[model samples]
Target: MSRTLFIIDVQNDFTEGGALGVEGGAAVAAGITEYLAEHGEAYDLVVASRDWHHADDDNGGHFATDAAPDFVTTWPKHCMAGTPGAEYHPALDTSRVDVHIRKGQGVPAYSIFEGTDDAGASIGEVLTQHGITDVDVVGIATDYCVRASALDALEHGQHVRVLRDLVAGVAPESSEAALAELGHAGAAIVESGALPTAGAGAPEDGDGEAGTAGDRA
Candidate 1:
């Protein structure tokens, strides 16, 4: 069974000091870059996703046009297409990414599943085409895009694991809630360190030791 590394939204807008910055966002980006640098060969494929929204439009009400905006459903503009905010964080080594998926063209698309690769291939299509049965997810804003991507992966029938150390969230409470939801939905939450070496324990999060991300329960 082949495995895929799903890097979600490590974009500039999601990192610290950016428009929609999270506290640990920059750390997550650098951590993921370092992880891939060392363990790039651990997975069969590496797919990265970004929020490439339209600059002019409201993005189907995803962005808040009024003064008072609901942070949950509506947000201040960020990650607009062709902008620096939409690009991956400078720390993230995108050269290692096998496929890049851009989502949120003119709508609210949080999941990487919403995006399509350079060849117009969707995430699900690429996974199926490559025979990817297991997926490990990592990136910024765990409570939002990362959470959405992981849940969708489980729904798509892929064995899903979220690497906690490689993810940063908007809020600690929401991030914890998201992880709980993922666990309840059958997605394993694990630390990146628990990923398997050659022929050792399989690269699955469920079998890892205590204190890993899956033990959040």
Candidate 2:
């Protein structure tokens, strides 16, 4: 089985100092960096997802704008395309990333798989073309992007695992709910340390840490 790691939305816009920062988002980058440094060579593929949007786009317009009325359900404007906020957090080690998927360019794309290239290839399609079957996911805001990507991977028939320790959330309650939903949808929740060592056997059940983001979910 070809194994792949999908790092989802570990961008500056979602972390501590950005426009729409989530609680614990910075920790996601730190944890993922640690995991990659310790197990960089274990996976055959490494991919990342980034949210790229335009300031005047519909998604961005949903938030308060000097030119538009504020929508109660909308969030703050963030992750403008090509800006520093749209880039992955500086702490995440991107040296091993073989693919980078940019999402939410013109729409409310919550899933990395929803991202398409100029030629219309999806993240899933790219992974399929690359022969990746087993996928592990890590990144920010467990209730949103991370959960959506993991579910989309499972739907694509890939064996999916969520790195419980390497994710954060906009809120604890919603994050917990999302994790339970992912588990019910057949995603394995695992800790970074318990990931299979290269050439070692896969675990019967993906080992997860207590009190982690997914645990609250």
Candidate 3:
């Protein structure tokens, strides 16, 4: 019944003031910090991920190289390694993180499974080594990295949950769609306040239906 927390891409580049800032990104960061402060000990491990792209290369076409950029496939240069954008948000308490993973080094990567730990271990390897059977994911851009990470966790045979209140997204419609997809893929969707004590009360099954937030669009 080991539970692990996956804090995905809470770096400066994805926060409210960064290169790819989301609307509620700053609030999500602060909310996660508050959640951790109250329930830090609930999980066996806390892993934080960052988009540590290279400055020279296009990172497997993840970054736009042409004059016109497609927001879907190509993004403005961001999270370059060793740059301020690659650093974790100042509001994030890194001291609580047990492992640090760097992704999209020189390629396109979204899921935490695509990254390696500080010790050069894959996310799957680390989880297996830790006997992590349950996972809770929270971070920036719910429609992308967070969604990818949660699906990968489920694929790895772990019971997965996404804390809705602790995440922000790039767009309301896409974010709600992503949540529906994750739910359909067997990941539980729950609010942070509704999460039960780890191993004591398990997450309820998701209905695989899209949330109401997308209606604003």
Quantify all predictions' global Cα lDDT against the true fold.
0.85, 0.79, 0.85
> What TM-score fits each model?
0.93, 0.87, 0.92
In model 1, state the lDDT of residue 192: 75
lDDT of 3 by residue, 1-217 (tens): 8889999998888987788988877777788898888778888999999999999999999999876668788899999999999998888888999999999989999999999988899999999999999898999779889988999999999988888888888899888888888877888777777665544555444532335333211
Once superposed on the true structure, which residue ranges of model 3 sit more than 4 Å away at CA? 196-217
Which residue pairs collide in model 1, if any? Answer: none
Q: Rank the candidates by TM-score, best first.
A: 1, 3, 2
Better of 1 and 2 by lDDT: 1
lDDT of 1 by residue, 155-215 (tens): 9999888887888888877888888788788887777777765445475456633232322
RMSD, one per candidate, in order: 2.5, 2.9, 2.5
TM-score (C-alpha) between model 1 and the true structure: 0.93
Q: What is the clash tally of candidate 3?
A: 0
